[model samples]
Target: MSDNGHQNVTMITCTAPVNIAVIKYWGKRDEELILPINSSLSVTLHQDQLKTTTTIACSKSFQEDRIWLNGKEEDIRHPRLQSCLREIRRLARKRRNSGSPTSDVTSVSHKVHICSVNNFPTAAGLASSAAGYACLVYTLSQLFGVDGELSVVARQGSGSACRSLYGGFVQWKMGERSNGTDSVAEQVAPESHWPELRVLILVVSAEQKSVGSTSGMHTSVKTSDLLTYRADAVVPSRMEEMIGAIRQRNFAAFGELTMKDSNQFHATCLDTYPPIFYLNNISHKIISLVHRYNQHYGEIRVAYTFDAGPNAVIYTLQEHLPEFLQVVCHFFPPEVNGGEFLKGHPVHSSPLSEELKRAINLEPTAKGIRYIISTKVGPGPCVVEDPDLHLLGADGLPKKNA
Candidate 1:
């Protein structure tokens, strides 16, 4: 696998999409191992609107393992990064020792340079870690010519990351094994499983999280009784119901469960000592708007979920998108008139009803949201075949134009 004279360099680029957990994963039994206390379900948003792109290069001449995220170089000694690198190299070595002639032994020993960037915001509680780590593990596998179930390694980077390994509806099973080897993400349904399903991400705030998920989870695990109760008694049944809802395409059930699960997750946060506050005033109003909109239709037309931040992820179907967006616009006026506020699948113009406005009963707040990302279920991480798309140049460093 070593390039001749260490002059040859091997590079691979890949992209992965973000996922919104309807059934939130808040507490972890094993922090360093990143094993969740309960199973979680999420919808993988389309990569076109929200994704992370990563490029990795391996060469014998490189001095050390280095990584750059969203332009700045990040520490490669990060325990999670080391975990992924260690696992991938271990697998490669195992394969070689097993007499697999195709395994690249020389390249496996070479150091690597990784460059990653997110098209969307980072650390703003939008599952950027999920996409980033998924992309990293996938791109590394491609660069080293190693392939198989890498979701376990991805989970080491971020507990939620394992879900990004699959597209559409995914579930992170809280495996019972003490070693956490059984814990892995599995696809509950494909992207085409529900074509009408639509998702709208309300970017309430793009600022970095006041309390990171890792620390918040640790605090919750240490203090909150509610966390233990929910993980032990609540999530198992909810997981089963959620999977059934997706398999049967039951939107109402799915939406209700999503909202309730989100509420319960936040409730656990409140139950924690010193407590974490993920929802701001803006998030509260969005919740009211969603409920009022659903009340107007006498059904669960939309549902909202939050994870470690104030941003709201709304779930609905294609037909309801335009009207719901109109409701959003009425309550939260855009900063710029007719700006490209709505992204992803284009939503047709729709008029807001007087009854709906009265039902919402809130004054329009200018710029409550930075923007809205409209998307739906998307596929898992994919290899980028075009060399021009690579973030690193031939010298194994980020390109200036990248």
Candidate 2:
């Protein structure tokens, strides 16, 4: 609420980081509630590299709810969007009803106008929804003055969005409750837990995904029996072992589990009746490069993981970044000297080896990769205190220059 009067608009802006799952969530136990069939784990990347910035304004003068995503106006009546907005309001009402002093008194009945933008291009096939919905839920909670465990509400927007509520190593526990009350995300370790680790995103294509995650996962649940086995038998023990690996800072164990789980998830996608192919020639080539690179070194120095898209995310230590990056730059050179080559954290220069190049033995594929983002583990959602950074104007509309 604004200090001027009831007619005044109140606005808040926030940013949320993206999370890449090591243990993927491929199926759902319940679609409406967005409950997963199995638990999953992920590492939250730094907000400096990939993130969503959302601004929400509430005012009595607004006629109705409106939303703009990535500079384009969108329907506010979308079912998933409505689910997130309604759940936040309900929590605020419940807190007020309980005579809690922390509940927001104003803007409870005012219509809202939301504007969101992503730092990275949506065409990169990164986890945009994971960051978008998480930012939406976090910003809305700030406006509604509701706190404590908003992951359940965030999950309604996207299952993976729940994991974005925390930083570093996170686990989305598939709770046993039928009502989905206990299905929440918890932090397994903080970002500072592993300072030497780094992430590199190999953008294979900047095209929108042919199949979205929600629809794709639904198909897998219905047609793939392997999904049932992996969810029931494989993920349980794997989750425990992965946690131990993270705790002990064992790169070999952690890297192995990450690669295998990613492979199994894609295998389940193939087992679907029509079969979904998220990996392209570029993705397969990157996988081969990682394998041969590790084989030549006589150790697992790097690992690769893919989601429901062609992009490949590589996990390795900081000491290995320079050499591996040089290997990548050699095979997939940028179009222009400084164009579409790299984004995010910069890596130091290191020369590629002739023997290793011979071992890879693959022809250069020009522009196979759009760019590479070098980053590391980072914190979760954050509020931007600078007033000039706000995306909306006083009239509850997107600013011209935002």
Q: Tell me how far the alpha carbon of residue 144 in candidate 1 is from the true structure, in angstroms, after superposition.
A: 1.8
Model 1 bad stretches (over 4 Å)? 1-7
Task: Compose the digit string of candidate 1's lDDT tens values, residues 1-402.
Answer: 244534678888999999999999988898878999999999999999989999999887899999999889999999999999999998888887887878887889999999999998899999999999999999888777777779999999999999998899999999999788989999999999999999999999899999999889999999999999999999999999999999999999999999999999999999999999999999999998899788888999999998889999999998898999998988898887756777777889899778878887888899998889889899999999999999998888899967
- For candidate 1, give the lDDT: 0.91
Q: Write the per-residue lDDT of candidate 2 for residues 37-61, one digit (tens) a residue.
A: 9999999999999899999999887
RMSD of 1: 1.8
**Residue clash pairs of candidate 2:** none
Model 1 weakest lDDT span, ten residues long: 1-10
How many clashes show up per model? Answer: 4, 0
Tell me the whole-model lDDT of each prediction, alpha carbons only. Answer: 0.91, 0.91
Model 2 superposed RMSD (Cα) = 1.9
Cα-based TM-score, every candidate: 0.97, 0.97
